[model samples]
Target: METVVGIEDTEDGKFEDSGVDRSSSALSSPKQISNPIVYKLVRVEGDGRLVPATDDEVMEVGDFLECENSEMHVVADTGQSLECISIERSSSGNLQLECSEGTAEADMGKLNAKLQYIEQILQKVKEEEKQRISCGSPVHSHLNVDSQCSADKFPAMDGKVQSENQEIPSIASSLNYTHSSGSIDQCSRPSEGVIESGSSASAVYSNLKPDLSMSDGEICLDKLSIRELHELFKVTFGRETTVKDKQWLKRRIAMSLTNSCDVSATTFIIKDNKIVRKFEEDSSGNLNAASLISLENMTEEEDGNFKDSSPVKDCGSDDNRVVSETRLGNCSIGYELEDENHQTEQRAAKRIRKPTKRYIEELSENESREHNPRLLISNKSTGHGHVSPTSYVRPAARNVFSEVRIYVTRSDYLGGSDVQIPCVSRVRRSRPRKDNTSLMKFHPTGMSETATKLSNKLLEHCSDAGSEIPDNVLKSRMPAKFHQPASSEPAKEKQCPTTGTAELRQELRPKRADSCSHTSDDDIVTVPTAKGGMRRKHHRAWTLIEVMKLVEGVSRCGAGRWSEIKRLSFSSYSYRTSVDLKDKWRNLLKASSALTPSPADDGMNSRKHGTAPIPEKILLRVRELAEMNSQVPPSYSSSNLAAGAGSVHGRDRSGYL
Candidate 1:
């Protein structure tokens, strides 16, 4: 008989070969296999520390060995367990294992205690889900009914119950109800529900809402291109619209002109805006009168016709119109009338002319004729009018006055006794005489004999008195030597009696008597003689002492004439000399007197009081020596002698020596 072996049972409840042929063709062939199941390696430690395991290592739990390629559940050590629910192998050789539902392994009693502790947490999650879907609306309405029904039963069913009833070995097994081959089923699937749930969360983050029209209809902000929207925005609103206001204005404009026709069909007429049309019509009739007047004045000045008629009245006239004709012609006679009138009036007025040299000469001649006379008198005629009428006429030979020897004294009685005799005779110019004999005859003497006798007596008295005789008597008493007899024979025969010889003899006799009488009175004659002489009478000679006394007396009396001093008399000549000498002596004496010592007489000592006494002896000695020598010595040498002598004398003579 052949030895037979059956398959052993694994702890995961799968078949496993206990013994098999070695190196045989049967060993290479694939045997029967179960569906892939993934398991979860749950960490039941208090901390989340995991034991690292290698992909090639067979994970062993309490009594089971996890299959490397199958989904299984097994209990592990170190407070952790492994449940293999599904297995996946990537192209890169990465092994992925997923866990089954309700497959955890831990201390059963402790896990049960933790499950009781998490009872409130389960209830809170249920409350949150209920609040999320309040108002009888499900949060995800498009979710598949099977998946939602299964997920809804999780909170009511315990882990033990789930483990016995439905064992979801992996996330892939659980997701198989809604997916296929790792891709989500879009048809009859809940992907939109999931997406909408996430979208609601995103909308809360960005504070934005989806537009229902964009979802239901064919509209999307993201689908609209920038160029299409820009044109739409400009047409609905304006070209210059902002992004924020553009939407609003576009909506309003779309509502207003939604049916507007295209403007490209016909030519568009651009009518003026209301303001421009109004301004044009108003400005047409507007005119400033002042501006028009100013323009007229400007034209008048430019044409050189500032006084032209007002342009308002002449604005439409042809004469006032500015033409091409030259305006220079209008200024030709404008100022002629004023200039001609001035010239004509100027021509009618008279103008004074300056006189010529010939006229000046004629006037000068007339003035000369009026001022100076033609008749002129001579000096001879003027003298003739002053001549006396009773002047004598004499013969040609007797025209010369006869110098008769007649003696006329001062007492001559020619006119009267007191008459002033003509002591100085002048020749009279006589007229021509008829008889030469009468003219030659000497006229009777103008003095009478009695007068001649009295004059002789007077001359004798004057000589006796020794007084100065009058010059008139001396001249008259002298003889006139020239004589002439009459031209008759009898007058010629007699001598003329020697005209003044008798008179002289008689005058000489009285003069001799008067001289004899004058000699007898000596006092009278000599006193006058002494007065007339140049010599002075000696009363007392002017000695030096007397001269000094007089000077002192006169000085006390003040400056006066010497004659007024009763102490002395001086002759006229000596008196003047004496006065001058007194002045000189007083000056000399003042200098000498000032040198006298004071009563204290302390000249020998040094000037303890800072004062010097006068040196009287030295001054007197110097003066006496000067008189003897007749020369003044040098003041320095003299001053030394004076100082020495003053000292000696002051000691010798106490106050005076």
Candidate 2:
């Protein structure tokens, strides 16, 4: 070979060129193999091929060159090249660079830029570290394994964390961090500094590893200042966190306490659990801070289990033991306390005293009989020709005038037929004078007046004798003035002597006889026949006017014969032939008054004078009688008879008929 290069010399090579600067490879001699610095090739320019840059060639990592007519770049360091690494263009026009044991160094400018980028990254990391320290971490380097942070160290943290550890002693007296154990340990650090224990950090880190037991564990990463804790929670519980998880834990603990103890005790414990540490003393009676924290952690973890273990208990009194029966529709025994004994006595006194069989049968028979149809006649046997006492037969009148006598009974009378005794007096009838002139000198007008007076006197006697005129009879009488003919104009007179006097006497006398005969028949027509013959056959038929007149006269004087008339008869010859003429007249008058016009207007007035238009006097009398009858009690037999006879027969006859 031309000049063999010594491997030993190259192993510990040096640049010693004097004309060329040894400080940089660019200034070195091309043929001298001086110090060869290695670099990684990071980038290349377009269409560049990497060929071996000779010792004389100054090459950079991104330099383009031609090798064997192919484009390449300085892609690897000398060491990489020694290790058979190369960068070449593939058939698809892409560069393929590879190294076995060493990477190609970049160009000096690129390496310097990368180193500046790394310096900036280091600066950012220092800034983040400073921010983390200012805010507080869950763990710090200064805390002892068993010792916890001061109670006031973490002023913003919940008391639940502080209450987890109570055994830590004061160290950094000014630090305000609260240890998981609830003890108030003062430390020498500043009040604002947090001192997290190493054990807590380790525990937090260990908890972050995926564990199947904690798969369902929920974590809350809230406004807590503990960054590591937040991280651990995110890692352990899959990062979808909320405040609800912490609330759920608190609720479970509260529910457990409520169920396990009385309300007073449970509320006390729950409120205390938030601020004070609950501890279990060790065998040596020493409270370990770590043990306290562990207990609190265990409590928090087992809160759900504790709630499941305990159940609510009944706290009612003995009176509540009996189940109450609900009453239907508000129905209840409303008995008072005072009635309790009465009710009990009543219940005890109650005996099932069933009715006797015969009594029950009798009741059933009575009910059946009430439902059955009644028989109109009774069944009983009797001897031949023996009349049944049940048969009702009206007893016959015991005397000829018994019925009439009963009819005439007065208000004071009891049952008796008292025949009125007649006091006989004799009056001689004046014999018809043979010499008519002397005896007839008595004035006919005076005789007529005397007869009228006698008639009125007789009527008074008849009315006094208890023969009261019926209301129908009185109502049927005509008006008093109806029959009095109106006065006619006076006749002309002529002067004459004895012959004229005699002629006048004949004329007046004949006229008087005719008038007397006509009036006699007219008055007798109203009277009944003695033989019960037709009244019209034996008597003159009465005109309506005559009937009215008769009715008025009877109403005025009460019912009687002509001798008993109160006023002189306008027609003088009438006579009543019936033995009980007054009674028969009363009946006839009543029947005539009772007759009403037929519906077909039979030429008669429909209105009965007294019956339709009852006189005010009669109505007043009726009301008075009713009032008097009402005053009499029904229990008195005399009063009953009086009332019955008076009401049923006298004034009440119109209604009955």
Candidate 3:
């Protein structure tokens, strides 16, 4: 047949254009259609055509359904839309949908009632706070409340029923008040029917809801989170809460409720001021009066206990839970031998126990030593900026010291313990400049032997704890000193060689023979070599006696004639070159300028200098020296006279005979 054919490239890349009818093959292959639902189909392609669709008519989700001449289109309804088919085949055949036809606001009276109730509760709580403030008791007033109620049968808020006031004994211990201890008791009890402990606890226990429910069911108090419970405590007693100690918080809340008489709960008894135990008195109210008179502590089953030193008399009623107890010995810090009668009285008391461990001793058993933070006893006040009887035991400074010590003592570069924390990646940079630049503008160019010796001693101890400087670096920083004797004959001096750091650091290495012959009098003379040569210097120091001799020679020979002075007095100083003599005299003049008192301070310095009595012989010599210069007879101030004969001697130097 000469008919059109569809061409498609096969997987092998061959174009197959066969002239054949694929419709016949598909029809003969059995149409894979499952049970299909019937729909009334209307064709809108040509003229108006409406036809009932066969049961097998193809349909699927997203196929557009449009009413003729309408702009809207909805997805084809594929799921069972017929009520008869769904009812016949499904298990939820009888399901009837109930739609809410009215708005929730239509029931205003019920909502308003709930709002009013919540407002009233908040008002009551606020009023209680105000009263506490007036009475000098904060909401966070007392560490523990003292509720005057019968045992277990806590009065409910509605006053209609009673519930058991209960908690595990472990919780009592965790109410540790880890920070401080205080009792500003003036805590008012909740009104009758204010607390529904059993129902509230159950509700909170079951669902742990915080928000108030608007359902028809009665609203119950929610289980407080650690923070919420802490806030409750802080507002009630002004006690700080430890967020980390969740165990302590839950117990504290329970204890607070137990102590409140207003909550109509059972009273909690304190043991040795450490443990909080429950206290149950008789309901007849007779025991309340007797309790005031009696010094004996109360006793109960499984919960409350207090120490009683009072003699036990049989009440004859089985209701009295007190049992005569015997103790083998005492574990108190300062226990004394008991008197015969006193011991007998203790023996007769209705206190019974198996002689168990103390509270602290028991606590030690459950906790491991490794996991605990060191707690040193702190006797000082907490100093929390409160004018209250609060003395909290804070975490001591020892813990901080321990942590810092651990960090400092780390052996590796990474400073890692169990977990690895890499050391900071420092950038590669040149070494820091450590050579100290002199601060003074006019530092001495040279020092006498005494000054040099003193400076050496001081420099030896100049080690900074922050960064230790190497010995070679320190030695390199010291200026070269000259100690030469002037002489008529000139002698060649050995010069120091310019050495690298490795050679200069010979002092740091093992003791070795010095290769350089640079002797004691060799000064670090900077001689200009040809050009572009490193400067070389020799090590030497000037002595005080040599300096004094140079001064005397300068005074005798006059300052300008350096070679003559060097030959006359410094003859034995073979190392004293003419230039060295001149340099020495110039420094002496500079030093004399510092020693000479300022002109303005002359009169004041005279009286001040009077205390330093100079020898009469020195004054006579000064007068003798002055006689030779009678041409311009010098007038000397007391300050100049007190400065010594050097100032006087130098005074006539300009026209010395």
Candidate 4:
């Protein structure tokens, strides 16, 4: 780099004849330049290295003399330049010149040497990273070390790590300037001293700037554009990326450069209109511990001894704890690898729940049906029992499952006592109505066989014991009066010994045992068989007493209140419903209107067919109630007779009144 300075040609170099004396005198005593021309100062050291000058270092025309072994001189483009000006002490304790029409070139060799030094440091960093990776150090540990190293080396940058490419030139330029509060002082150029002393440039370059301040070590990579970051990324990682996200690019570049798992801190991120700072995570304490361990390992590796590398002997007293920590680190690494693999391949699969019992049963049933339908059918038919092959008659398919009784024959117990031992059936769930109907339809033959077997057993027992049948059962077995024996009586009589077992069973078996005869004797009604699949409700006839109570109830409660009548009067007659009372009342009303009373008969009247007769007064009371309620058939002529009867009754009641 070169700097331009403007100067006035004072007296047109008038002291040329005595130039040597005048130049020596002007060099000894300097004067400030008083020209209206603008000048840019480039600081040239006594050793000949060039750097930019600050405002305070630029001398005015009348500054005082200050020099020690270093003299202020002017080197203008025109060889015969004007007078020398002011002099001042540079902060580095060297003399600086403020002069007219001066130009100088920056020392490229020194800058190149500085750049090489930066590259060497970067190379050392890469080598250390490779060594850490080779020694089985985790990426997170490397990141933590990088963070700490960065914080220590560039304490002023606030985690803002820039690429070496951007940092090297700045570092080289900053090398010439020493940090100071007032002004940047120029340091002595090493090449100038070595060259003046007749030393080789190699010797000068070998001993680089020892005075370079760590305070000037900041590199601002956050200001880099996406294209620059991409280039940096390629240079650092030897790869290419299509991602345009600035944060991701910066993070990738930083990680590649540092060989770490973490990015630089959020404070260093560039905030612009397009890019904004998001949430920041705090530095983990684990990272710090890992970093310390990593640093210790590196020191151990460098020293080539592992025994003395422990930093906290008292803390990690147990070797097992160290082993456990290593195990935990390995586990974390494994988990990270697994997560990466999962992400790279596809998302993790959802966990499945165990099948429910119903589902398993359904699945099993379906499998059985698909593979062996007959096995499923047999299992259901036998109700999970083993059916004997000899008696396993394949029953018709039923909608439900039920257990069947399979009696063991007498032959099986022939060697034992003659007393029969009943086979106990397994308890099962009650079949639904539909299942019951289906069972009846499916196994009618089985039922018939059961009935025959039971009858045979009873007959054998009765004959063997010579027990007489009950008189009532014998009476029931006797033929009805109208049931005539057919002409084939001899055939029936011939077959009497072998009559069907069902008929024999019915004839022999009484409904109740002798001990329960008392209950059986009380109004034993045999339900007449109906043709319908469902039996009809038995019709119970209303008695004279019930009719009298109903009439009394009607008189007290008025008519059409059968529910009230039934609740108050016929409460004990559970079989006599309110509907039955309503029906009986209707019949009584019709009978009252139809039956003409003979004047001789005033008491209870009986029908020709004998049944307990309802009293005439009760019938008359029912008619009176019906007439009073108007819900009955109107007996127009009977009303007149009723009035005459009422008057006659009134006349009879008059004497009592």
Q: Choose the strongest candidate by TM-score.
A: 4
* Model 2 agreement with the true structure over 477-592: per-residue lDDT tens digits: 21221111111001000011111112111111110111111222232233465866434322222222223333333333333432333123222111222222344345343443
What lDDT tens digits, residue by residue, belong to model 3 across residues 1-657?
A: 000000001100000000000111110111111121111121111111212332232121012211210211010010100110111110000000000001111122221221122122222333333343344331211211111111111111101100000121111101110000000001111211112111222232122122222210100012445565566445323356766565555344333332221111111111101111112322111122122111111123111211221111111110111100000000000112223332233223212111011111111111111011111111001000111111111111011010000000001111011110000000001111121112000001111111111111011111010011111123332222111221101111101111111111111111111211231113234446686553434322233334445554544544555776665554333334567777855654443443344434322322233322212222232233333323222354223323433554565333231
List the candidates' TM-scores in order: 0.11, 0.12, 0.16, 0.18
Select the stronger candidate by TM-score from 3 and 4. Answer: 4
lDDT accuracy of residue 100 in candidate 3:
6
In model 1, the runs with Cα more than 4 Å from the true position are: 1-105, 113-121, 136-657
Candidate rank order under TM-score? 4, 3, 2, 1
**Candidate 4 TM-score, C-alpha based:** 0.18
Residue 339's C-alpha lDDT in candidate 3? Answer: 30
Model 4, position 436: C-alpha lDDT score: 17
Task: Note the clash tally of each candidate.
Answer: 16, 35, 19, 4
* After superposition, candidate 3 runs with Cα above 4 Å error: 1-530, 598-657
lDDT of each: 0.18, 0.19, 0.19, 0.24
